[model samples]
Target chain A: MLAFLLDPAALSGPADGASDMHPTRQRLISVATRLFQQRGYHAIGLAEILALSETPKGSLYHHFPGGKPELAEACVTRIAESSLAAIDRLSGSGLDMIGFLRRLAEVTAAWLQRTDWLDGSLLAVIGQEQGGVNGPLSEAVRIAYQRIEMRLARWLMAEGVAVARARDMAATIIAAQEGALVLARSRHDAAPVTLVTDMLCTMVDRG
Target chain B: MLAFLLDPAALSGPADGASDMHPTRQRLISVATRLFQQRGYHAIGLAEILALSETPKGSLYHHFPGGKPELAEACVTRIAESSLAAIDRLSGSGLDMIGFLRRLAEVTAAWLQRTDWLDGSLLAVIGQEQGGVNGPLSEAVRIAYQRIEMRLARWLMAEGVAVARARDMAATIIAAQEGALVLARSRHDAAPVTLVTDMLCTMVDRG
Candidate 1:
């Protein structure tokens, strides 16, 4: 669980005005998304996000319109786009399932270190805290997960894994990756993420 | 990533007044632990905890003089003690590492179902939300994870795994389990958890 890639990459979704969005609006969403990822929805306030982004409160209302949840929805959209792009970028390359996962481990570890462990998967933080309760956010979270899983499953199926097995493998991989991020952040170490990938790759090699 | 088992099982630790504590206090801790596990530390409030537990405000203050965080610390303590006991109980049985992991998956899945997907790892929810920011809470979360990792590593070492490899495997398993809980809860399905354990067990069995 890391922040979304800003490049947006070559994926199959609308860009959502991210490139052309107002600078102030983009700053608010970026700041809010990171804060929400770190401290969660209930803990952080809009004032802090506004002050951190150096944007006035009126512009926030003007851009987000629906305030916090609305902004969070944008965060979800941005995250989903960025994350899917990341997956696409990795999978489309010459990486198999294990290679794709190993690369993910490296990227996530670097991200954690670069951010000083302050950032994690926004969808994960939101999903765990507000998973079933936060309506639109929760729905987005579910869809994002499903999309990521489907992509991973497709990768597995390409390797001749049965459809059911591929789906299960994808689900398990995602769970471990997300869970590893939490553990790594909590322990202030990235070994957990790398370890899981290593173990999985080793197992696959053995088979 | 589930609530603490109440029986406390056999292990070493101060009982911490759980058994003979005032019913009101016990109820407060129990209610607070479950709520914190579900909605996270910041999302749920003292008033809501009190209302859910049906305890008077006076009783709440009398038990936890330090208030919300204090109660949360108690919840953490209770959970830590409970989780350690769960580990001890599982490992001390005749189950090997694979069986131990398999049993854990089943229990976690059932816990998810029994709780209607609301409950998950308390330390995980709190750790992600307040991991680095909340001082005492963060410290407790780190220790809890370390203790669990050590226990799992010991189990692996018992299987003749080398020290470093066992440690990585332990760390990876914990990360996956915790992450699986988040995914399972988000999707309101326990298959993610069961799927992870099954994959790990199959890999182990194959080896």
Candidate 2:
């Protein structure tokens, strides 16, 4: 679900820390992703991101010539990649379908509580902020969500669910998770997500 | 769900044309609600709302002493009232649980297609944009959602579901519907919401 935005991968630079990549550029992405997740896309400014990242004011343009939108695009892509990686890791862990979902929900709920409910799935924020608008950022948001859905569908299919049913269930789970996160944030509590987790578990058990 | 933003009441002046209320104020609220639903709360400016509402540039502060935040408060309240009215109308129709949920989803899907997916629930947008922050606007957003949830729970209870389960189902339904709307808007199709409707119907039938 959109909970992938809360993954530590979203806040860290590339795993290898290749010498060719500038550390400042990675820092900027990390800061921007954090801010975007906590606040809506439009509520944040480039100046704040640069200051928080400790990058030189003029260097933002040097690294991202396209400015805010360009930086936003990079953050979206980073989040998507990190989220897909997390899903792959979970899927490979040998947990049953219900076990995997429960673990995912627990991680998400913990993150929400840790952050004081200030952060949620960046994909959800961006999707709502920029959905239906044709742009690189919007396209990035769409792709991120699709990747999560596909990964979930694969996990469901591996559990012996029919292809069509797996896909539908994956979509429903993703949608339900995203919605529950919103409710959790709004109510300043994680119980909504817990309820959703139970509901999804029941559905999986029924099948 | 957040689908109430698509209600015509959200875009029109108060019903029964009160003699004391200024039409310009009503127009401003209507325009602001529409823009806020389509775009994030922080992305839109007062100038744009006033221009679209056809209100005089100087009259904005006169109608809304608190400026954009105050205006946002009014829009939130208007949406909540309109949404409650919609729920009341649906409940009074005496449709069975599945029938009512399916009809609600169908109407929401039709609205998404009508606006070409440019609009969604104002409550969803505000809840994501301002939730977890302390302010009147954020509080208003919370109240709006709670009202919707309560109305839904009341319907479920009326259908013989236990109170605890009814509340949980209400929250799940609201969250799922909001999430499905985001998915549908992002994918530029109503199939996501249609899938959600089916999932919701099954859950309701089970109860």
Candidate topping DockQ? 2
Model 2, A1-207: lDDT tens digits are 644535545457353233366888878888888888778799998789988988887899999999999988888887777766677777788999899878978888888887888887787888888857898998888887788888878878988988998888888888888888888898887888888878778778887
State which candidate has the highest TM-score: 2
Error of 2 at B20 (Å): 6.4
Q: Against the hidden true structure, what lDDT does model 2 obtain?
A: 0.80
Docking quality (DockQ) for each candidate: 0.69, 0.72
Model 1 has a DockQ score of 0.69
The per-candidate TM-score of the B chain, in the order shown, comes to: 0.86, 0.92
For candidate 1, write residues B1-207 as lDDT tens digits.
Answer: 423233222112344435666778778888887788778889897889989989989989998898888898878877776776677767778888788888887778777787677777888888888845748888888888888778767877887788987787778778878888888888898888887786667645543
- Weakest lDDT window of 10 consecutive positions for candidate 1 chain B: B4-13
Runs in model 1 lying further than 4 Å from the true structure: A2-17, A203-207, B2-17, B203-207
Worst-scoring 10-residue span by lDDT in model 2 chain B: B10-19
